[model samples]
Target: AMDDREVLLTRQEVTVAEHGDWAEVELYEAYQNQTWERQEVVYYFSLPESAVITGLWLGDSAERSERFAYRVSPRGAAQAVYRHEVRRRVDPALLEQIGPRQYRLRIFPVEPQRRDWDQDTNRMVVEDGPSLHMWLTYRVLIKIEEGGDVWPLPQLAEKRNVYWDDTSDRLVNGEPMAADEETWLPPAVPATSFVEPGIHRVDFPGGESVIARPASDEDLPAWPEDLHLAVVLDRSRSMAGRQAEVRAALAQLRRIADSDTVVDVYLTASEYHGEEPTLVELSWLDLGSITYAGGQNAAGLLAQFEALHAGQEYAAIFVFTDGSGYELGDGGFDVSVPGAPVWMVHLGDDLPLGYDDATLEAIQASGGGVAGDVREALTRLAVALEGEAYDVVDGYVWDVLPTEAADARDALDGDFAPFAARWLILAEMQRHRGEINELETLDYLHDVAVEYGVVTPYSSMIVLVNERQEKLLDELEARGDRFEREYERVGETEGQNALTVTGVPEPEEWLLLALAAVALALLYLYPRLSARGTLFTKVSHH
Candidate 1:
C-alpha cells in the first residue's frame, strides 16, 4: 500500500491533513468574467518575511530571495531569534534508502549546530516541542541540584508535581509541594533552615532537598495554603508596546498579594547567555532575599509566589499578555504555578496566530511538526500578538470560562449586561468544575458582586427583603429538636457525605455576601413565590 499522501518535513513523514486548495476547490467559468485575476489563485504556503511577494512559491523568482537566505536577530532581553534555511539538501544517493522512489529529502534543525534547547512554550512542556528561533544569550539561572548541584531539570517543574518533605505539609525546596498534604502526612516540625535567607544548600537530615531560596514571615504570621500564586509575563518585543497594561496588571496583582496573595513572577524572553535555554523568573518578590542589584532565579521567584499565597483561603493567577506563549525546551511551557484553583487573567484580543479567534488551543497545535516552524512560532507568533489579547471563550454559559473573573467582568456590560452578565459568570464557574454548589459557587460569584458594587444593600426594599429571608433561619431553628433526635452524633469524618436534609451550606465571607443578595431577591419575590414568609417552610424532612 503506497502512501502517496505522505510527505516528509524535516525528516519525519506526516499524512497530509485534509485542506482545500485551488486544486481541490471546484470552480467553473461564469460567462463574461472569464479573465482570471492574479488573486484568484489561493495559496496555502507560508512566506519568509510577511507582507509582499505574496502567494505560494510557484517557482524561483528574485523577489523570493528570502526563500534562499534568511537570518534572525534577538529583539529584547535574550529573546531567541530563529532563521530558516535548507540546513541540508537530500543526497541523491540516499533516495534508495527511502521507500518512495520519486524523491526523499532529509532536513534537520535550521541551526543544526545549536546546543541550546529549543522551546514551544505556548503549551505544556511534557508534550510539545521547542521553538526554532535562533539562540540568544540569557542570564545564568542556577537551581541547587541534589548533592552539590547534580543534574539540572530539563524543564521547570510544575508545583504540586515535585516534592521533598517527609510530610507533604512540610516545605519542598521550601514551598507547599503537595496539594493532598492534609490527608496524606501527619504534621511535623517547621524546618528553620527553610526560613533562613541565602543560597546555602543543606541536606534535610532524612528528607529530600529541592532547589529553593529561603524566605519566611518572621515578623508576621504564616501564609494560608490557599493564598499561593504564580504570575507569568511575556517579554517578547511585541509585548514592549503593551508593557503598561502588563505592569498595571502586575501592580494590581502585587497590591492583592500585599493583603493576602502570595505572588511570584516569571519573564520569558530569548535565552541570553544562560547555561540553559529557558524562560527566566527575574524577581523573587521575597523581601528577605534581596540581592544587591535585585534580580532572581526560578526557585527564588516561585518561593516568593508561594509565600504570597501562603495564608489566604482563596488563590488566583493573573497572566497579562497578548497571548503569544513561549517556545520552551521539550517544546512546551515550563509551568509550576499551583493553588486551590488557578485564575488566568489573559488580556486584550490579540492572538499568537495571525488569524482571528486564535487560541491557546490553536497555538499549542501550530507547530507544523517541523523544527523550524516550532522554533519560529516562539518569536514571530508575537507578530499577530502585538495587537490585543481577547478571551476566546465568549458567552458566559459556554462552560470553559476565562480564568480571571475581573477581566471577564471588564469585557462585560450593558442592560441585561449587569445581572445577566453575572449569571453568565456563575454559569462560567460551574462550567469549569461540576462540584460547585451554593457556598463554593457564591465565592466566585461574589467577585461579580463586588465589581458590580452590590457588596452592601442599597435600598430599603433590599433591607426589608434581607429581614424577611431571616424566616429561613427561624424555620431551620424550629427543626433543631427533630434534627438532633433523628441524627445521632457521627463516628468520624466518615458518613459526612450522607445525603440528607437539615444541612446548610456553611457560607464563607464571600458566600455570606451572596446570601445577603439572595435574601434581598427572595424578599422582593415574596409577593410572587411565597405570598408571605420564606423560601423554605417549617418542616423536618428527615
Candidate 2:
C-alpha cells in the first residue's frame, strides 16, 4: 500500500488582482515529498459568473524542465479542453470559454534523484532519503462583462489528486498572509470594446470609430465580345482508345460556340503529311481526322495558335491531350498570351503521361489557367462565359458550375478523378517540402500512388533518373583518375630519359645524302652512254 499514498502539501497561497474587465489570479503551492517516477498534480479554480477564460501563464520554477505534460479542462469534463504536451505556452483563443464556471489545471513532474518508496516512513513518501522540495505557480487571466465590478476573486479548491497514489487530498492549513505581503500590481489599461459579429461601426467617447465587416465577394469581370477560342487536339498513338471521348468533348464545346465566339481547331502530332493543324470548321471534325499516330507536339500547336490569333486581344486556348508523347519533342512552347488564358484538359486514366505533372502545371500557370480533366475545363469555361464570379472557399478560389453548366458537362464521357487525385498528391508534397526529407517525400509519393492507382514519376522515373545520373558521374570520375595516372607515368619516364640520346634518325639528313649519291652516278653514266651510241652508229653504217 506504499504506492497508494499521496504526497502532503506543506504550504499553499492564492492571490488575486483586479484589472479593468480582467482579473489575474496567481496560485502558489509547495510539496515536500517527491518521486523519481513522474507524478501528476491537479489544481482547480472556481471562476465568477459571466467570466470568459482568456489566457493562462505558467510561472517559471525549478521543475519546469522536468514538466512533461500540462492540460486544462472544464469542471467534470471527460476530455481536456486544452492540452499541450510539447509546449508550455498556451494561447488565449484556445482557452476561450463562455459558460464554464470552473476549470482544472494538471501538471506532471519527473524528478530523477528521488525514489518511489521510503522504508523509514512506514508509508508512502516521495523518496526514501532527505526531504525533496517541489513548488508550482500559475497565473490565469479572465475577461468579465463590461461595466461589471471585479469582486469575489477566483478561489482555489482544496481538493487535489496525485497520480502515483491514486488518492484525493486536501491542502494543509498555513498562516494567513497580510495584505502588505501581496506582490506589486501593474496599472490597468482601458479595455477596448469587442466588435459586433457583422458589419458595423463602434464609436468611442472621443469621436473616434472603428469599422468591422466581413469580407465581401469580388465582382466578376464583364464577358468580352469577339472572344476567339482555340482548341488544340492531341492526335498521338497513345490516344487511340480515347479518341471517342475526345471527339465527344469537342462536340460539346462546339455547341457552346456562338456567333461572337470564333472557334479554331488545331491537330498536333510528330509527323504530319502536309501543312498540319490547319484551320477547319467545327463540322469538319470527324473520326477519320483523328488518326492517332506519331508523337504529341505541343510546341507546334502553340506556333499554330500564335499564327492564327495574331493581334487578337480576347482569346482562350484549350489543349486536349492524353498526357502521352509529351516528352518526345521540345517543351519550349511559348504559352504567354497577354489577355488570353490557356486551359489544359488532361485526357485518359491512370496512364503515365509523357509530360511530367510539373511541366504541365507550369504551362497552365503561365496563362493563369488550370489543368484538369475535360469536364473540369468545360465547366470552368462555361462559368467564365456567363460572367460569374469564382467561388472562394477556405482561402482558395474554385470554379463552381451552375446547374445548367453542370448538366452540359456531365454529358461528356470522360473521368477526371485520376488527375484530381494526382493534383492532391502534388499539393501535399509541395506543402510539406520544407518539413520532410527527400526520402520521406519519395515514400509519401509511393504510398499515395499505390492508394490511388495513379502513375507518378516522382517515386519511379525521377528517382531512377537521379540514381542513373549519380552512377554516370562516378564512372566519369573513375575514368578521369585513370587518365591522370597514365599522364603522370608518361611524364616520369620522359623525365628519367632527359639526359640520354634517343638515337633516332633525322629524315632531313638521310634525304640530303641520297640526293648527293644519285647526282654523282647520273653524271658518270650520261657521258659514257653518249660516246658509245655515236661509235656504234658509225660502225653499223660502214
Pick by TM-score: which candidate is best? Answer: 2
lDDT of 2 by residue, 385-431 (tens): 55323322111233322333332322221122232233344444434
Candidate 2 least-lDDT 10 residues: 484-493
Give the C-alpha miss distance for residue 490 in model 2, angstroms.
Answer: 42
Clashes of each: 50, 0
C-alpha lDDT of residue 18 in model 1: 16
Tens-digit lDDT string for candidate 1 (40-158): 11001111110011011111222324222211101110010000011111100000000000011111121111111113222111111221111011011122323332111111111
C-alpha displacement of 211 in model 1, angstroms?
A: 46
For all predicted structures, in order, the TM-scores are 0.23, 0.31
> How well does model 2 score by local distance difference test?
0.38
